[model samples]
Target: MSITFEKLSYTYQTGTPFEHHALQDISLTIADHSYTAIIGHTGSGKSTLLQHLNGLLKPTSGKLVVNGQMIDTKTKNKQLGDLRHEVGFVFQFPEAQLFEETVLKDISFGPKNLGKSETEALEIARQKAKLVNLPDDVLEKSPFELSGGQMRRVAIAGILAMQPNILVLDEPTAGLDPKGRIEMMEMFKQLYEKEKLTIILVTHNMNDVANYADNVIVLEQGRLLRQGVPTEIFSNPEWLNKHHLGLPQTTAFALKLQERGINLQELPLTEKKLAQKLAALLQREVK
Candidate 1:
C-alpha cells in the first residue's frame, strides 16, 4: 500500500480560541515497501503527520490518501477504523498502553478486536511474541511484571498480531539504553526486509535515518521544508545547520575529515564504512 498527501493542512480547535495549525499544504508520496523517515524538531508537525497516516486525524482543507482510502473533511468516521487494522501504529512509549492481566492477552488484543476467534488470536499472539523475540514463558506472566524492555516487546507484539502491511513507528526507541536501542532498531530493519513491510519512522535521531531510511522528509514550522534521500539532504551541512539538524555521526565525521584536507570521496553513514575508509587511507600513506 502507498500514501499520498496533497496540499494537506490540519488545524486543531478550528474556530475556537485555541486554534493551532499543525500542518500546512503538505504534499508527498510514500511508495509501498519503502523505509521513510520523518525528521523535525518539536512542534514541527511530525506528530500531527503520523496521526493522519492511520486516519486518526482528518485533513481540514486538503486530500490525503492511504492505501486507497481518500480522507478529507467529508470522510466518514465509520470508514476510518478499517485503516487502523492495516496500519500498525507504535506510538512513543507504547508499553504504557498495556493493561491486560497477562502478556498473551495483551498481545492478542488487536487481533481479537478485529474479530478473530479466540483460538486464532491465541495462535497469532504466540507467533508475534516469538517474532519480537519474547520468551514463550512470558506469555503466561503479567505484562506489568516484565522489565521495561520486555514490556515494550509485548506492546509491539500486539501491533504485529494485526498483520499490518505498513508499520508506522513514532519514536519507537525513546527510553532504551544504547544497546537496547540498537537491538530494537535492528529488529525493525529485519522486519522491513523479511516481511516487505513499509516503515514510516518519525525520529529526531539522525543516525537512525542515515543507517536505515531510504528517504527523508523534513518538516519545518508546520510546512514541508524538504524531502530527499539522506545523502542529498544531509550532505549540505549549511542547510542542516540552518535547520537545527545534524548528519549521522559517521557522515559528520567524514565531513570534518574532508574539511581538514583528507580525500574521502564520499561521506560514510555507518561506523563500519567509516572505519574501512580511514584504514584504507592509512594503508595508502604507509605504502
Candidate 2:
C-alpha cells in the first residue's frame, strides 16, 4: 500500500521542558511495492520518521496517511492496531524482541494475535520461516538459544507471518558481520521481489542503499535533505560529503577516475563493474 506524509511534524515530551521537535514539516510519498531507503546520521529523525509510518508514533501536528487512511492524533486504538498489521515494523536488532519459549511460538505470535487457529498460525510460521531462510529444526528450539543471526531471522519471520504489505525495517543489518549483512539484505531483496512487498529500510550503510534501494531519502537534522533515485543521489559526492555521508566505494573510485580524464560513460555502483571499467581502460592504454 502507498504511504503519504503531508507536512508531518512531531515533538518529544510536548507541553513540558525538554520538548524537542523530531520532524519538521516532512512531506513524502512512498509508492506501493517500491524499495526505499532512509539514510541519516544519529539524531536526524530517521527513526522518529519511520515510527510515524506504521502509526507507532503520531505526528504532533500534520497527517500520516497510509493505504488511504489518515492516522492523526485522534486515531483510535483499534484503527492503530489495524495499521500495525498492514505495516509491519522490524526495528533495529529486532531479534531482541523475540520472547516466546520456542521459535515456533515466537513466529506464530502475530498470526495468533490476528485470531488464526493454532494449526493455521503454525502453518503460517513455517511458511515465513522459509521466507527468512530459517531451517525447520530451529522451530522447536528456544529463540534465545540460537545464535544472534538466527534470532534475527526468526524475528523477521515473526513479522512476515503477519503478512504485511509494507515491511518497514530500521537498521535491520546492524551488528551482523559483512557476509551476514550481505546475506540478510539479499534475503530482503528476494522477499520483496517474490512477494511484491513494499520495503522501507532505514539504515546508515551507503553500500546497502547502493545495492538494494530503488530510491534514497537523505535526512539531516530532522529535515528532508534530498530524495531521488540512487544514481541521482550518489552522483553528487560533494553533496553527500557535505552531509557527512559518502558514496559507495565504487562511486568514489569512479569519481577519482573521472578526475584523471577517464570518462566512464556511466557511474558504477558495484566493485565488479568498477573492475571491468578499469580493465577496459588498461587495455585501451596498452593499445
Candidate 3:
C-alpha cells in the first residue's frame, strides 16, 4: 500500500504558549513494497512525520492519504483502527512493550486484540515467532526473562502476527551490537523480499541506510532536506554534511580517494562494491 502526504503540518499543543510545529508543509509519496529510510538528528521531526502515516496523529493542516484513505480530524475512529492494522508500527526499544506473562501471550496480543480466536492467534504467533527467529522453547518462558535482543524479536513478532502490509520501525536497532544490528537488518530485507512488505525505518545510522534502504529521506528541523536513492544521496557528501548528515563510511572513502586525484566517477556505498572499484582502478594504473 502507498502513502501520500500533501502539505501536511502538525503543531504540538496548538493554541497554547508551548506550541511547537513538528512538521511543516511536508509532502511525499511512499510507494508500495519499497524499503525507505527516514534519517535525521534528534528533534528533527522524523518521528513526528512517521506518526501521521498510520493516523496515530492527525495533521493540523493539509492532507495525509494512506492506501487511498484521506486522514484528518474528522476521520472516524473505525477508519483509524483499520489503518493501524494495515500499517504496523514497531516503536524504539519495542521490548519495553512486552508485558504479558509469556512470550506466546505477548506476541499474540495484537491478533487477540483484533478478535482472533485463541487457537488462531497462537498459530499466527508461532508463524511470527519463526519469522523473527524466536525459538519454540522461548514461547513458554516469561518475556521479562529473555535477553534484550530476544525481547525485541518477540515485540516485533507481535506486530507481524497482525499481518500488516506496511511496516514502520522507529530505531529498530537502537541498542544492539554490530552483529545484532546486521541480523535485524537482514531479517527485514528478507521479509521485504518475501512478503512484498513496504518497510519504513527511521534511524540515525547512515551505514544502514546505504546498505539496506532503496530510498532515503533526510529531515532537518521539521523539514525535508532531501529525498532520493542511496547512491544519489550519499554521492554528494558535502551536500549531506551541510544538512548535518553524512555519507556511509565506504562513500566517504570514495570521496577521499577523489580528493587525492583518483578519478572514480561512480561513488561506492558498500564495502564489496568499493573493493571491486578499487581493484579495477589499481589494474588500470599498473598498466
Candidate 4:
C-alpha cells in the first residue's frame, strides 16, 4: 500500500495556549512494497508522522492519503479502525503491551478480535510464531516468561498474525544488543522480500537505514528536509552535519579516511561496500 501526504500538517491542542505544530507542509509519496526509513532527531515530528500512517492521529488542517483513504479535517476518527487492520503498527517497545496468558494467545489476539475462529486464529498465530523465529515449545508459555528478545519476537508475531499489507514500525530494535538488533532488522528485510510487505520504519539508527532501506526520509523540526536513496543522502555529509544528523558507523569511518586524504571512488553506505572499495584502492597501491 502507498502513502501520500499533501501539505499535511498536524497540530496538537489547536487554539490552546500549549498548542504545538508537530508537522508542517509535509508532502511525500512512499511507494508501495518499498522499505522506507524515516529518520530524525527527537521531537522532529518522526513519531507524529508515524501516527498518521495508520490513522492513529488525524490531520488538523491538511490532507493525508493512506492506502487509499483520504484523511482531512472532516475525516472521522471511527473510519480509521478499518484502515488500521490493513496497516498494522508495531509500536516502540510493543513487548510492553503484551499481557496475554500465553504467547500463542498474544499472537492470536488480533485475528480473533477481527472475527476469525479460535482454530483459524491459533493456526495463523502458529505460522506467525515460526515467521518470527519463535519455536513451538514457547507457544504455550506466558509471554512475560520469555527473554526480552523473544518477547519482541512474540510482539512482532502478533502484528504479523493480522496479515497486514503494510507494516509500520516505530524504533523496533531500540533496546537490543548488537546481534539482536541485526537479527531483528534482517527479519523485517525477509518479510519485505518473502511477503512483499511495505515497511515504513521510524528510527534513529542510521546504519539500519544504510543497510536495509530502499528510500530514506529525513525530517527536521517538523519539516521535510530531504528524501532519497541512502547513498545519495549520505553523499552530502556537509548537509547532514549541518542538521546534526549522523551517518552509518562505517560510512563515518570512510569519511574520516577521506579527511586523511584516502581516495576511494565514492562514499560507501555499508561495511561490505566500504571493504570492497578499500580493497580495490589497496590493490592499486600494490600495483
Any runs in candidate 4 off by more than 4 Å, and if so which?
A: none
Q: Give the alpha carbon lDDT tens digit for every residue of 126-239 in model 4.
A: 999999899889999999999999999999999999899999999999899999999999999999999999999999889999999999999999999999999999998898
**Index of the highest-TM-score prediction:** 4
Summing lDDT over every window of 10 consecutive residues in candidate 1, give the lowest-scoring window: 77-86
lDDT scores in order? 0.93, 0.90, 0.90, 0.92
lDDT of 2 by residue, 112-229 (tens): 9999999999999999999999988889999999999999999999999999999998999999999899899999999899999999999888888888999888888889888998
- RMSD vs true structure, all candidates: 1.3, 1.7, 1.3, 1.1
lDDT of 3 at 4: 88
After superposition, the stretches of candidate 2 with alpha carbons farther than 4 Å from their true spots are: 279-287
Per residue, candidate 3 scores C-alpha lDDT tens digits across 60-96 of 9999898878997677667787788899898889898
Q: After best superposition, candidate 4 residue 100: deviation in angstroms?
A: 1.6
TM-scores of all candidate predictions against the true structure: 0.96, 0.94, 0.96, 0.97
Q: Tell how far residue 207 is off in model 1, in angstroms.
A: 0.7
In every candidate, how many clashes are there?
0, 0, 0, 0
Which regions of candidate 3 deviate over 4 angstroms? Answer: none
lDDT accuracy of residue 1 in candidate 1: 62
Comparing 2 with 4 on TM-score, the higher-scoring candidate is: 4
Residue 182 lDDT (model 3): 91
In the range 1-287, model 1's lDDT, one tens digit per residue, is 68999999999999999999999999999999999999999999999999988888999989888999888989888988878888899999999999999999999998898899999999999999998999998899999999888999999999999999999999999999999999899999988999899999999899999999998999999999999998898878889899999889889889989999999888888888889999999999999
Q: lDDT: which is higher, 1 or 2?
A: 1
Give the TM-score (vs. native) of candidate 4: 0.97
